[model samples]
Target: MIDVTMTRAYEMMVILYALSIVLYFIDYFYKQAKIRRTAFWIVSIVWVMQTVFFLLYIMEMKRFPVLTLIEGVYFYAWLLITISIILHCIARVDLPVFFINILGFIFVTIHLFAPDQVQNPLGESAVSEMLIIHISFAILSYATFTLTFVFSVLYLILYKILKKKKFSKLWSRLPSLQQISMWINSSILIGNPLFFISILLGLEWAFMTLEGLSVIDAKIIGSFIIFVIYLIILVLHRKGKLSGLNYSWANIYTFLLVVINFFLGSKLSNFHLWY
Candidate 1:
């Protein structure tokens, strides 16, 4: 049976994340510094709760519990929150943290409410270490892409606001379009290499464990398509064919496709789905 105490703590964490998001938006639009500070503190508290839950979960499982889809999503959400906190302190940026926590909230909420299948914990030998490395890099790459997508979105929003001459407090908070573009480009540069390495490792694992690499697998094809899309973006950026709003729009479209592939296409995949 599920541990009721841990389950309650998890639900509370979700609530805190949601509350923090609401506070952030309120502060953004209202220009309330106090509310923004409160939101940041709320985020800190939420992180602490998440840490407690993590410790409790590890104690209960006697191993890291990220071998399955739900657990993996939860772990990723926690990871993003941790990174967001650190980045926020160093950069004093709020919008990215707001968007990240929103995504984290969604991820954890899904993990909490969705029907979870119980499976025995696997020993370290059950899954090869190489596969874990591949999956870790894949998850990190996805997280990096998410940040890039967020900055691109900020570029678009700020551009529209500037064009319309509707200035708000949030306007001042956003980085310039040039800065946002640079961040997007850098994120893609970092994420693409990591994802490329992940694919290589995955292929290595397949060659070693399976009859042969499954090039036709739905997940592999979907991942390859996303990779190609990003590669195109990188090429366009390098050749000076895309920049500013054009690049931002392309990122938005690519990110939308990525979201669909991750959330929907996985359901159709033979190997990627958790069930």
Candidate 2:
């Protein structure tokens, strides 16, 4: 009976989180301060509920919730939401907050619907702190990159609107294309170093624990590819070769590559599997 009740609670949490995502989107498009405020509170409430849920799981399992792939994703999403809330409060970037919640919602909803991986408490226990650090930084990098992608796309849309001279409430609410481009650039600048560190940590952990990792492994190769793309974009920007629409377009392409690398590479990588 308790299990069933907690299951229902979990579903309720998901529903509330999903609603918060919708409210955030509405706030973004409608340009309502009240709607944004409401969305923030909803996100805060759901974040608290998620924290409690994880605490309960920790008590029940007698370990951290990172023992399973689904639990890891949930925890990662929680971190992303927590960071988004902090940024929303400090920076007041509603569009980025909205898109960040969209990613969080998709991750948790997918975890709910997907088949569960077997709990490998023994293996999970054996995982080193270095490995955990690597994963945490990698997830953070992805979150930043997701923000970069959204801002770049927004820059493009706003550019189009300005070019067409289409004035609307949304247009008035949006930052200029130059400002959005700066956000994109900042995200990339931050994410690149973090992701680079994550790669180094991952390699170190692999060598220490698994003897070594294959260079050809899908995740490794894909990560390196992403790193190279990020480096290339930075170089181009420095050389004044990519800017404005070209800069945004490069980000769009990079984001697409990341999506494919995540979904496709994960499936094919033995080293990246949970169990």
Candidate 3:
């Protein structure tokens, strides 16, 4: 019964954390004070729950829960949440807080899913949990990139419409070209790092767990290719070699590669079972 209760509480905490992230995302883009306040309250609740869990673990273990990898991840996540709340209240640095929470959320998810200890030499369960973390990070990055693609498409449409002097209600409804471009840049800024981290974690897990795994596996190669392309795209944009319609088109094309790699690479991978 205690185990069941703890599991349920963790689930509730995760739900609230996810909701807070959504609220933060909205507040980030819309700059709505009420939404930001609500997100702050929700994050506060999550922090309290995390504190309760942290204390409980300490009491149960009779020590600080930071000696092992799993314990360290939980502690790191709690630290992130604590700092994010403090920053939200005092520093008023919005972007850093949001990104900190994102990192916290990833670690929290990993802690929730990972086994407390590896019981055997193989550690199959622990390896599987790491795979889940890898997939979670990858999907989150993909979602961010999808948002970037959408904004880029909108920017293109707006650019064409304005260039042709076709004024309509749509022009009023959409954000200005500069704002859309900023959103595109912000999404890429966040998404690229996330994808890179996912790739690193996935590679580490594979090396540790999978015997005789080849580096030329379809998914591995495809993911690396995609990462390199995005890095190049970001560098080009920074160097002013890619901008305006060309930048938007570059994003669109790269997203197509992401989609293809996601589907085709998964299908071709020998051990990439999750779909």
Candidate 4:
């Protein structure tokens, strides 16, 4: 079964991710077009392998691999690739190969090298499918935020280039300012509805099970703060009240909040972290 295979698949992905990172870094500073292509090929092949691994995990476990630190790292790598693909699609931003690979590499490195922790498959068959929906969106929101953080960092680099009038490297590689702003908007649009619905379902599920008690724990607080911040950003963006600089700042802030929620907040606040 692929669930059993996931372990092997993860190991392979780590190797590939590391190799890709090395190649990408070499390509980035050396200005070798062929090296960049080779790096992307390595990344792409591993992503496909991991994609299959992910699908198999869901099938065997009947749950998204968002639980446990290791699985979370795996999913984070997938999220980075997904975001990179999306950004690549709409903006055609030629972000340094290693810039994207770094996040993926970190995830795999942690998964492979860090101490083992038990994974919590919270989607036990007993839970209602509705509850599953809540859990699904929770992961999706977190993943989206992960993507935003990476992109925001790239945006800052591009902005600096624009400021310095050094358009050679950054201008050629990154997306236009308008495209990055739109990317921010699109990430929010995808994440916002999912966040809203997930919370509602979470509350409903808890109410049905725990007599309407929603624990005001770290997990909930983290998610709530993230949602509120994004909501405000959405409003500001819509109203044209947020400058590109401010938008980038908000993206970074929200991403930091997401990370905290994933690690610290979830540990302190919610039962959600177990999964």
**Candidate number with greatest TM-score:** 1
Give the CA lDDT, 0 to 100, for residue 224 in model 4: 76
* TM-score, model 2 to reference: 0.87
Model 4 ranges off by over 4 Å: 1-9, 86-90, 114-126
lDDT tens digits, residue span 113-172, model 3: 987652222333544656656756776687677667767887888899999999574345
lDDT of 2 by residue, 14-100 (tens): 898888888878876777778778878988998998899879977876655664568778877887788789879876777667777
What's the CA error at residue 80 for candidate 4, in Å?
Answer: 1.9
In candidate 3, what residue range of length 10 has the lowest lDDT sum?
118-127
TM-scores for all candidates? Answer: 0.88, 0.87, 0.56, 0.83
Best-first order by TM-score: 1, 2, 4, 3
Q: Please write out the lDDT profile of model 1 over residues 124-222, one tens digit for every residue.
A: 454677877777788888888888889998898889999999977657887777878888998899998898898888878767765644578766777
Model 1 worst lDDT run, 10 consecutive residues: 117-126
Assess each prediction's global lDDT (C-alpha) against the native. 0.80, 0.81, 0.79, 0.71
Model 4's lDDT to the true fold? Answer: 0.71
Q: Sort by lDDT, best first: what order?
A: 2, 1, 3, 4
> Candidate 4 residues 1-275, lDDT tens each?
95457677778878887887787667656668888777777878887887887797687666655556566677767877766555545554556335666776777677667766544444353367666677677767766666566667767878888898888852475677777767667778888778888888877776675543556666776677778889998898799998678788988988887777767875675455453
Where does candidate 4 clash, by residue pair?
217-269, 218-269
Runs with alpha carbons beyond 4 Å of true place in candidate 3 = 1-129
Model 2 pairs in collision: none
